[model samples]
Target: MIKELLEAKETDSFDELCVRLGNFLGIGKAVPPKVLLRAIDDPPFADNLIVCRNTPGFLQSLFDDPKTAQYDGDAGKKKEDGKSNTELIAKAATAFLKWGKAGFSTVDEATLERRENACLACPNLSEPKNKLQKLVAVKLDKERVGRRTGDKTCKICGCNVARKIKLPGESCPDSHPAIEGMTRWNEPQRVAAAVAE
Candidate 1:
């Protein structure tokens, strides 16, 4: 059914296709899937939406993993990036000290999956964490359950792929240094616009 939705032609309305896809996925009516789909500017974004929707069953498998299910809270351990714990700690402390006026940033599921998929394909991304586990005050099962990662962190942004992508208006800053507003998720659209201009 999702595949059918993906196969929809340009003539097909994204809204109608999403309602059908959402129905098949059993996505609840609280937030219409069409609303989510509208955040997607293009088809690749739509493809990512289908791929990364975290169904309950999928989340269960992540929580079942021993390495991910429990929160070790070992922030000082040597990360795969080989930066010293002390150095990373200093960097974190500096950021914390400077942090101010943070606002909640939200994006529909489609945008996040699309950005994450881009990070997954980026060469600058070295070692990626298999999953994300964090402590939550509420202790709900779903909250405790870890979410799988497409990539752990971005070398360019010095932030985790999942976290960085979720920021309200962030773009990938790959090495080129002049990729202006180009993120891994929207490179094609950016290129098309550049060509047109």
Candidate 2:
């Protein structure tokens, strides 16, 4: 029975699922693995076991751009190590899992509804609304257009580049010119114009 239940859920490795099921059933309280396994196999308890054992996921993906968020008052500057992102996501995922876990007990139907509501209400768990979703959405929309931007190298040095760069852009140094017209489209155009020598 445990075997079949394990097969049915298929969420993680069998060992991890077994640990989760054990944890759910209060196994450390003298519950033997075989006994717990048999109990889970019982057709009657299949749904219960599946619900208890499933791992909950994060509520929403993040807004990934570093630029706009730089000036946004809330959330402040994203840190260098990306710890801010991990911490924010960890909090949301933990709360969401907690909300789901509390649902399994005799916690009434209203309680479960409350968990769902609370998860939805959580700001971090909330769907990336407005500006947040726009970041990922625009990138995905570009991908769906079936063209690769091939934004891969420095036009000047022919070296692979992390970002678009030009000496005239104030991005180069303090004394560099402010390249107002330079855009991704200008990349090849400028390269062509320069290389004609």
Per-residue accuracy of model 1 over 131-155 as CA lDDT, tens digit each: 4222111122322211234335556
Which number leads on TM-score?
A: 1
Q: TM per model?
A: 0.32, 0.18
lDDT, model 1, position 110: 79
Regions more than 4 Å wrong, model 1 = 1-102, 128-146, 175-181, 187-197
Q: Candidate 2, residues 28-56: lDDT per residue as tens digits? A: 22222332233222211222233333232
How does candidate 2 score on lDDT?
0.29
**What's the lDDT for all of these models?**
0.39, 0.29
TM-score between candidate 2 and the true structure: 0.18
Q: Kindly report which residue stretches of model 2 are placed more than 4 angstroms away from their true locations once superposed.
A: 1-11, 29-33, 44-197
* C-alpha RMSD of each candidate structure in angstroms: 18.5, 23.9
